[model samples]
Structure formats: structure tokens, C-alpha cells
Target: MRQDTEVRTFRDGPSPATRRRVLAGGALAAGLGGVGAAASEARTAEVGGVRHGTVRADGVDVFYREAGRPDAPVFLLLHGFANSSFYFRHLMPRLADRFRLIAPDLPSFGFTVVPDDRGYVYDFASLSRTVGAFVDALGLRRYLLYTFDYGAPVGWDLALAHPERIAGIVSQNGNAYLEGLGEAAWAPLRAYWAKPNAAAVESIRARMTLDGVKAPYFHGVPDPSVIEPESYTLDAAILARPGNADRQVTLKLDYKRNLERYPLIQAYFRERRPKLLAVWGRNDLFFIPPGAEAFRRDIPDARVRFLDTGHFALETNGDDIAREIRDFF
Candidate 1:
């Protein structure tokens, strides 16, 4: 039993390089217009005519990609670490045609633009509040959630805090419980949380690889030239910023903080009982399959599906995931 049990992770786990992988990307389209406005127009045209928008929160500007008419049912999408709002690019169009889709770049990541002189902290609770504020700012009465990776905690907490406003939940490769990790797999994050300093930061950054980034999903090709070089370059730039490393390490520290709050989050999901869906990249090396299993154990009546992809399953199997979310509505 001990030997067999040695193989799991999730219900667990952060770092300096960890910080870089997490907050590595933002935008300043408070109105999703002007320079962003023209881009939104092009996006709408690309996706069969949806809306483009940006929101201002805390001290940063958040750029968002939305589709469908404002009056339609709402679908709120959240992304994971080391990723910006770009994770949902392909999926947005597919669902935007049927529902009011809203995808934000969060605060420190993406083109929404972070403040030059301020220190930004990206914790689950902080991000949760950011999302909540964005939802409230848009005046969305209630909306479905599409959460992935780090997004699951942020969005889940938001839904728990505001159950009245949640329609249903669609999660892919997200964690909602404790005790889900392998020791080797979780070491770096644990170290980062313990010591979020410069050395830790550089050490973690050095291990990241193009192949490593795509290892989370179960896709057909291992080398997708589209994502590797450019994404890593963008993330490298963010890591170079002053204090940005610490902001990222703070996000890693939240793993323990979030784990402590896991029971409450599960209770919220149980008592409120929103429609929950789980999609996974069977190939994810970090947050393994058991994480999905734990979510099902608590989220009673969750619809779970697995894909042969990596961590960012949305990038590879977006259309199918988007359809699953739309069908739920």
C-alpha cells in the first residue's frame, strides 16, 4: 500500500522561479477599446461578432476577451499560472456564439498592463477578489465559470463567496482538495513557498523547458512551435522585472493558505451545489489525475471528462471543452 500510494500529488503545494512561471504575463484596456478597441473589433469579426472588453482593478488594468451579446447568458473563464487570458483564446469563440463569454488576463499577467511602480501580489484570494470585482463591475447577475489550473481555486472561491451569482462550474485540470501530490513533483513549489528569494527564483526558472510547458496535456504533438519560444520569452521578461519575482513567490505561498481553506471551499461547493464539470489533460505531470478524482468526491454529481493532452488542455482540445461548457448551459 505504501509503495502504491507513493504516486500522487495535488491536494498539495510554490517558488522564486515559481513566481516567474506564475505571474509571467497583463493589458490596459480598461474599456477594451482605443488601441484595444480596434483589436476587439478584429476579435469580434474573427469569432463571428462577439464583444471585446477590459476592466480596471486594484492598481492594474485587465484586458479581457469576450464573445456573444451582453444580454445573453454569461460564461466566465479563468486561467492557470504562467498563463494569461490567452489560454482561452480558441475556446472563447466556440462558446461565445451561444453564451456571453468573458475571459480576463488577470492583473499581473497578459497585456492588460501592470503598474510600473507598484508591487503586485497574485494570491488565490486576491485573484478571487479581482475576479469578483470584475464580475460585479460588469453587472453580471449570475454566470457559469470555466476554470483551469490555478484558476480553479480563484474561481471556486469566488463562487463560494457569491453562490447566488454562480450558474454552474466548468473546471479543467483544477484542484479542490488537499493531499494530492507527489513529493518530487511538489518539491520546488514547496521550496519557493518557504523561501521566495532570488536564488530560488533563478533555480526554478532554469528548469522550465518548452517540452515541460506542454507536458500537462495529452495532445497529439509534443512540439507545438506556436507556443514554446514566444510564450517563454514573454514570461522571461516578466520575471526580469523588479519585485515581480516576489509577487510570484507570494502566489506560491498561497498553496498552503489555500489548502487550509480547502475544506471551506468544498463545503461551499457541497452546500450550494452548483453544476460542476471536470475536464483534464491526462498527461499533466504536476496536477495529476487524482486531483480530478478528489473534485468529483466533493462536488457531487460532477460531470468529468479526460483528454489526451497536457496541462493547458484548452489550448489543444479547446473546441471540445468549449462545447462541453456550452452544452451545460
Candidate 2:
């Protein structure tokens, strides 16, 4: 999961077509702003307790974990690449008393199911579209976005599409800066983007095994035993599903699209300057700590802290993260 955290700027400037699309999207976003704000005002009561359920949205059965008061300020948790909403199991209960937590399994991951019609693109853009629909289906008008790993792109995409809906952002090793892409770890991905052949596919899928599932969770923890076994066990089971490995490979190949959008994502931060809090695992090989510090460039007041953990910081610092989130939100 390691990446080269060197700043890279692709595409000198937006093409004429890109400019037109951005203008059109801006108009649409302005029109939709009031819709979410009004909805938030209506659902102001706190929810009762933690629960699990599924909602049919965007042609997928989206599974999610919910806790805290229905009327409490909402916190939308977006998990990383190898894990689902389950990754937030420990952190969710910790803050349930103060916040309304909604953590969903993105399409092609976790318990969420998508039909086999090949209609779903499984790329970041398509996943982002599905998440937007998922949020609408759940009637979540506004919330703080907690994004990690893969969730970073998805959450940012949603924010850009519906800026009015984002109350703030909490980035935990969720990289948006190009300098955060460390080359050594990103070799396989870079190879895939360049060649995209069977060998490249194999390189991307190499980590789909059990060892790979366990690697990130324990990467930098002083006492690996502190990380629950169930975390990797559940993720490995999901990865072993029929066609799941291939689906993941497809997503990995599509990661380049996210890199392409990095500039635009940064632009959103510079322009909108949403309230940002970044809690990073300093020892993380993937999305290294520098990525967290980079947030301040776009958001002067962004609060960034480094935890002594790995990619899955929650595995080692769940209590601290929960506390930080509670105080901040």
C-alpha cells in the first residue's frame, strides 16, 4: 500500500470541455444547496442506539452500521480499501453517545451486493455516484465526512458534487496530495496503469491473500496483539469471494483516474476551504504522514496530528481518534 508522496501536477490546465462541465456542475450544485440545508433542519432529533441494516439504492443493496441519536450531528464514516464499514466497529460505539454514525460498505466491497449485469463500472467515479445516491436514500442531508484510504477519493468526489452537504472533513491517512504517493509502494499500481496486462493485474491482486489483509492493520503497531483478529479475518473472507479478487484488481487499475482528479480535489479544498481535521498514522507506509501535513497548504486552519500506528490507525488508536472526533465535532 506504500506510495510515493511526491507532488505531481498533471494536465497543465482544464480543457475547454472540462471548463464547461465545471461551470454546469457549479450551477447544479448551487441549486441543490438549499435542499440539504432544509432537510437537515427537519431531522434534528437524535437517534436511539447502534444498529445494522441495508437500503436498496443505485441498483445495489447497501449495508451500513448506524449508531448515536438520529437528531445528533451526523458523522459519515468512509472505510479503506481492504475493509468495509466493519473497520469502524470499535470507533463507532466509542462516539455513539454524541454523534450519529453512518458507515456504509461501498459497492463491490463488504456485504453490499451488486447485480452481475456488468452495468456497474466499479471505478471511483461510479462508486462516488453510487455513494451520492446512497446518502440521498438514507436522507442524510449534511454530515462530517471521515474518509480513509479509498474512502478519500469517494468522499472528496461527493463533497465536490454536493459541497453544501459537507459540514466538515476528517481525513485519516486519506490522501489527496500527489506528494503523498510514495513510488516504492505504488510500483505495482504504476505498472498496471502503464501496461495493464495480465502481469500487472497479478501484481495488483498479489495482496488479495490473507497475509496481505493482515499487513496494513499491524504494519506499525508496537504490540500487534492489540489489533483484533476478527478485522483481518472478516476482510479475508470477503476478499476470497467468487470474482471478488478480480473486482478489486479492476478497481486498482481504475485508481489512476483518482490521481488524475487530484488537482481538482485540491482545488475544491483551496476554494471551499472546508473545516478539516487530519489524524494520521505516522508509521503508515501507505499515505504517509506527510500527506496529512499537506492539508494545511489548502486549509490554513486544518488540524493535523500523527498517531503512532499504521494504515488502519483505528486498530491501534481507536480511543484517541474517537476522543479527538468527539471534541472536534
TM-score of each: 0.75, 0.85
How displaced is residue 302 in candidate 1, in Å?
0.8
* Each prediction's whole-model lDDT (CA): 0.61, 0.77
Off by over 4 Å in 1: 1-47, 116-120, 191-202, 207-243
Per-residue lDDT for 228 in model 1?
48
Model 2 misplaced regions, further than 4 Å: 1-48
lDDT for each residue of candidate 2 in 98-180, tens digit (9 for 90 to 100): 66678989987899878786377778888887788777766666788999999999999999898887888999999998888
After the best TM-score superposition of candidate 2, give how far the Cα of residue 208 lies from its true spot, in angstroms: 0.4
